[model samples]
Target: MFRQSLPAGIGRMMASMLGDSPPSSRQGADAFPSSQSFHTTATLAAIPDPYKVLGVDRNASAGDIKKAYYGLAKKYHPDTNKDPNAKEKFAEAQSAYELLSDAKKRETYDRFGSAAFDQNGGFDPNAAAGGNPFAGAGGFHGFGGGFPGGFAADINFEDLFGAFTGGARRAGRGRRGPFQEVLVGEDIEVQTNISFMEAAKGTSKDVVITPLTECGTCKGDGLKAGAKRSQCRQCNGSGTRVHFMQGGFQVAATCDACGGAGMIVPRGSECGTCRGNGVVRDKKTITVDIPGGVEDGMRLRVAGEGDAPPTGTQAAPGTRTQRGDLYVSIRVAPDHRFSRSGSDILYTASIPLTTALLGGEVTIPTLDGEVKVKVATGTGTGDRITLSGMGMKKLGGRSRGYTPTGDLKVEFKVAMPKYLTANQRTILEVLADEMNDKTARRTMNIGKDSPPSEAGNAPTDSQKNEGFLKSAWHKLMNATKNGDGGNSASNPSKKESDDAKKSDKESK
Candidate 1:
């Protein structure tokens, strides 16, 4: 009954303002009869301090307050973060922002410490209509109840506070009011890989994305035709309802009736197109332009290319809508023959051993094409040859009329021949002898006398004598052990004796 009468009184008040006579004394008194059970008994002790909730100083500026709220919202918003307490912290930040962002609300809170907004304790709308509502509360002390002299009848609250809240009594065709919170849309990120050459030179790629877009059927309002919203009865349009707990503790939480929006739609009034969500999934193809000289693991940003914010949330009248950004992460594939360092390119070229010793022309592969380069005389292996302005083009060169390029460094590797013929060997040996190459002389077996002080090529006398004696002993033993007749044993022994005598004569 108490809930049913508040709107009736507002209607009557509006009627009186529109040239109708005011209600009679009996009618006015009956319209707002006191209801003890409907009055709130909760104190302000449990309410969190707005400044502390936002982690700001008592004297923070409005801009600073807004910045702090945005940072906290980004970290705690459910769309971006999945922490268990993110919703709670997000609610706390939003609640704090609501109080501190308003000049009148902040001033009142600073002076009265949240007690000024206490709706029930000793509050009587009928008595406060034309007189002081706090007269019995001892000069607004502790809100031990409500405000003293809430307001004079001459001052209409609806007109004065319309900008701060949804005015119930104001004449309007539809419900369009300031929302408590406005959240940005969700950001999107994607990754792609490009070849090494494509990274050196700019390229364009098409990326497919599925994102949330506003529903066209209902125009993002989430309402059927001719539908209207009403204030939630559970929370009295405060968006939060009080919860009583053990030990005299009181908690204010979001109203389940309206999903914390302070308003509820009539039964079966939701738009069928998006099922009251005001958004639908849509797949789109977007072209991304990659710049030249972009390094691996670089991210490119595209603005206003993400999901759109809900229609119900807006900063103010005539403010532009905000959309999130798109980020593209790039990965460059490695090349087979070429590697990069900053803006330079490195490559190795294999040249024949003869080409390194004598000046010659060798064809090398480069970014542009194969180019012939002259090898310097006596050029050795591991030598580097640099080709200026023949490497990767610098980033942003197309717009500058002339492209700036890096250098391509080519390293020379000498390739030696695996085999040589007799003619080649003889010529090389003659050449080594003319050049007095001691290493070649020691390594190769050319039938010639080696230089003195090097080891002798022949074995010593002891080596010859030991071989002759071993041969004679092995022959005699084998002839006897075989059990051959006297002729077979005597013939083998006779041959060994002759060979031993010949070896002794040569030594002498």
Candidate 2:
């Protein structure tokens, strides 16, 4: 396992205990300190117990640990907490939860002690080298690179720090080696509104977005021409440093000098285009192809079109930066004449009452175009006429131009006339009487005060009386037919009696 060089206070104490010279910083060619000189020994640097940091016991359940972590996080979150120590407390809680929540990590910590992790924290599978925790499975042994039964090699201190902190160094990032950290940019979302027809037929639209792109001059390296790199003095080129706690427990933290890159270009050697940043803000126009039959609230994704990673971030030796995705949110506007259900479309068709009763061909709008549909006789309001294969195209289960489609349902609505001509009224009344529509007959008096017939026939006074008598005779005949024996009691009118007497005299 790789251990970072000890701090000044701890270094002096360790030197006194081991009877060695005080640790001295290494002087590099660039006037930068690369490392510290110390004796080779598998010494244990104390770290806060995961249980104590979360204020929980060793026997605490996962639920209890999580609860404690959440409480600490909410109380000491940097955005809400104003105290200077709050940020450190929040980090401590996060680290504790990360370690204790993983069963394997917690078990290992319990078995081998808090500073021991699988490969990174210096676990010796062989255990032959005096059970020393710093004797790594690889050839390397201890902090000074030599042990009684092990070989010498460089140690990757970043992995050691990550193992101690439950891999917080690469949290939320892509999987990469300890030397190369892959940082993915953040996704961007934009909303746009389209008309109902456009949604059905599909349309192309251009969207403008301002995102961070790689700096052309620096080629995303953030380094100017002839710039020389140097080892970071803070972490001694190890990319990490140690923090001692109250109980002599030491925690590994990221070094601030190189932003965890382990190396740096001096202040004057920055890219002119991005000002030492690997990215620059630029506006780009993208034409998005909106497939047909896309519904409202549908999102379209454009790969590799999102923003760049944060500023001053440098990829290690071999890794490359990854851009995020661009998402377009669609909003379909409603239409007054049309509505949709799945792939089916509904259209309301209004026709005159005469056309509904007599049946006629009426033109209606469809997704394809306007077409004449036959309206059945006696068609009432809310009646639907389905035109197969005339609706929106299906967006699933098949490729474009070969997919099945839905039907266009045309619903009928009878439109009543506001006013009727005198002739039309009279004809309707006659028709109602012929049909024996009692409601229509009572609602509109049929004959009294009616205009002359369309055939120019006007009834005289006698003709009117004769017509009255004929109506009475028919009523009596109907009564007899119904087994009433024509005994519906009623006195005869004077005109009717006089007509009867004249008819009797003529018969004699």
Candidate 3:
């Protein structure tokens, strides 16, 4: 009777071991009172250590634990294994895995045994009586006689099964969820070089890109001509496979055969154009408007110009798939004559020495055009001339009703003549003599002790007839002979006195 109730494979193995003729039904009934009584007795037995249940040591690593769980789950799955107690053993292994996989839970189980998770003092037969409808009756309740709150609740059975089944998660249908909305096409980055003037002012450019699009031959269905579609055998047209876990929970995973589409075509029935991929690479052209005041290395975002999303990855039911943005990195060529500092432009202008000394108008190049700037008479090298509103436009400063602009600073570089002609040299010499004579007379006047003759005081005849150049020259010559380089020419020497007296006598 026990052999009859056992799975065919298990029954054969047991019969071979204990002989063909086993105990009769009446004898078996006498040994075990009822199925419920037997289940309760088995569940109340001492719980096995989690490490032993998973077939690992106490110091096993997390990877080891995971490997052992996958091996045991595959071997004891109710769908594959025919053993009558296979479901119960699988539940025990799953429970062990759930506890040992978590660092905190594992530590608690190791320190306090299974009692750490038990709300009650010990195993309670009443708790098992409150059976899980999903597991059906007579299901084995292992640790603590029931499921722990944080143990099986936190385990994602789909992920655990998918690890062995090699499956993917299917996109849910309906209004776009947060996770679905974030599944946009990838953004693209490209680099382009532009002229300096183009970067200073705005310009437009046409960019060519090859983005993925739905195939025209298969109409994004990934089917060849004359090929018929049929429901997927793996998922039974639902596009997902449900796996029943030990704790009365179910998990759905994407069907691997049809890739969650719930349909499939026979081999060699795929469309030749897209090779059953549903998407193809196509060329697209988009115009990008680069704004003014954009600096080098600045990225410009062009919306909906990048690669398109893969087929069947649309957002909401009514909305179409969103294309990612295109980021264009700008590289500005260097200008020989102009350099920038913020919004201001710096330019070096060369001016003749004569033009610098004598005030004149100088022509300077600006972004607008060449303009004449007035140079001061005493302008020197390294002098800067600022022209208002002739520089780059302000980036974000134009909203206050006044369009602000930066100044164009022109730095002067005095260009002195390296070679002078004969006639020029002669003229310069004469000019130099005249300047020296004027300077000597100014020096003499500055050395006078008295301030000046008063209006009422008339000048004497001797003062009026005084020869300033003669007196200055005689004083200078006398001071030079006396080795008194530091002496002033205000006082006359002995020789000057004798010469003056003789000149006066001769005149009389």
Best by TM-score: 2
For candidate 2, lDDT tens digit of each residue in 1-508?
2234444444454446445565256433322222344432432233457799899999999999999999999999855676877866777788678778888778867876643543333333434233443433221233432322232233344544444454443232222221223466878898888899998888998999998888888777777887756777877776656655553534455566666667666688888888777789999998888877888899987878998874344544444466877899999999898999988899999999889989999999887778888989999999998989887778864665487778899999999878875445645765676677777734334444434456766776655654554455466657778886766524347558788899999999
Across 59-138, the per-residue lDDT of candidate 1 in tens digits comes to 89999999999999999985566576786788778877977887877886776654354332222333334233322221
The whole-model lDDT of each prediction reads 0.61, 0.66, 0.59
In model 3, which range of ten residues has the least summed lDDT? 133-142
Better by TM-score, candidate 2 or 1 = 2
lDDT digits (tens) for residues 45-137 of candidate 3: 224577998999999999999999999999997556768778667766876787788797787667655433432123233333443211111
For candidate 2, list the clashing residue pairs, or say none.
46-249, 46-250
Q: For each predicted model, how many residue pairs clash, with residues at least 3 apart or on different chains?
A: 4, 2, 0
**For every model shown, what is its TM-score relative to the native structure?**
0.50, 0.56, 0.46
For model 1, the stretches where C-alpha displacement exceeds 4 angstroms are 1-182, 232-236, 240-261, 264-267, 310-320, 394-403, 421-431, 441-508
